[model samples]
Target: MSPLVADELAQWAQYIQSATGIYLDGSKGYLIETRFAPLLKEVGTTSFGELLRRTQVDTTGALRRKVVDAITTNETSFFRDNSPFELLQHKLIPDLIDTRNRSTGAVRPIPIRIWSAACSTGQEVYSIAMLFHELKVDLKRFDVRIFGTDISDRALAAASRGTFAKMEIDRGLPLDRLGRYFATDGQTYRVKDEIRAMATFRSINLLEPFTFPHKFDLVLCRNVAIYFTERDKARLFGSIARVMAPDGTLLIGSTETITGICPQFEPKRHVRSVFYSLKVNGS
Candidate 1:
């Protein structure tokens, strides 16, 4: 495999950071080389530098798309973290439902929109669908819409298909829930259409302006912002706050904190997990 050239690192890193808001340090050159080696060989490029130059010259942008897809991390699994989903099942969703029920001017089919930002390969999105299924929420009475978005077109394509390998199904998903929510086909599993219908997947760059027509009731932007610089993190959470309902809930990676990043949200502890709710008056 060809190594990433020493001098090309800064140029590639800057381009990646500028395009995706994902900071790639010098140490990540090996990662870039490993990911691109196959593509480099296929495209007849002998060095990463040559490949980079070709991508720059490709005005059609196909090579650029391939480069971007290679750089974006798509690591994910169903219920990858138990705390947030547990919080959703035990507290958050129930509370939101109660609030919707109590509203005097509530419309028929209470609207429940959930956005899973950076939902790579659809695991988290499918997991949310399973959560609702387990809750036995009468879907006929509620307009529950789940949106899963990621910057990688390749990831979104896989997510939209709702298929998972046996290994992926084993990770973080309980055997019984897996049996309940998915249909086995040979060694792989596919999310059942009923659950699949509850969610939609699309390519979204969080750094870009908001394009979704409606605000969400619950937003899960987990484990993704760790890649962004502090400024990008602030912009991301700020944008999320703008599109989140005042009483809406946000779940981020367990180790991630918004204290110094975005002040629009206040951390709220629930049992073993933490979720944020938009603070009134930006407190």
Candidate 2:
């Protein structure tokens, strides 16, 4: 590909994101060609520039969704990084439980709410379920609700299925955990029915609104905003701040730190990964 073609693809991605709130990460033109080339060829389009022109003129909305889904990175796996899970299992959960118990006295265990934003393929959310199960908490006793949301409907549907191929099941998942939590079915593995039912998956447009039906005690939106420009990052964190409860914890990807982007949250250092606590929010 020539430099000019790459540059035009980048521009088109920027336009798509700015117009439709779906980020393309600029480096994902290969994804566009890989996924859309067939459609483009089927439609008799020859080049990326021509495809872009067709997308602009065509208001049928099919091309837009296809492009966005193709370009959206759905890279995720079970127990993605051991350290973050460790921190959640050890540090954050204990602190959150104690704080909730002290704040709300009428219950045996206080309710805990969590959101896994940009949760691709549902592994991260399942990881959380395993942690709680390991803690020996009767899931029925404590009101625990986990919401896994992604911009891609395709991924959300897969997540809702609570099933994985052998390779995908093996990736980042320990053998013992897999054996206990998943049942082998022909060529694939499926999460236990009880564990799978603990989380709900949905399609969410994060750029549209900061409104969540309910405020969460913790939000894990890691690895989702790394490619956004500085200004977009600022807007994203601002939107997150709106939906977050005061004192709620926010975990981000290891490579991403909202230090300069969001000053309202206080950085809390943990052995696994640094998390930000909402010292203040849209009050």
Residue ranges of candidate 2 with Cα displaced over 4 Å: 1-11, 19-31, 42-44, 57-60, 105-110, 280-283
RMSD of each: 1.2, 2.9
Cα lDDT for residue 46, candidate 1: 75
lDDT of 1 by residue, 1-283 (tens): 5667778888889888888899988888887888888789888977888888898899998888898899988899888878788899999888888888788887888889999999999999989888888888889888899999998989999999998998888889898988898898688899999999999888888999976788899999998999999999999999999999889999999889998679999989878898898999974
**Top-TM-score candidate index:** 1
lDDT of all predictions, in order shown?
Answer: 0.89, 0.78
Task: Assess candidate 1 and give its lDDT.
Answer: 0.89
Task: Name the TM-score of candidate 2.
Answer: 0.88
How many clashes in each structure? 0, 0
Per lDDT, the best of the predicted structures is 1
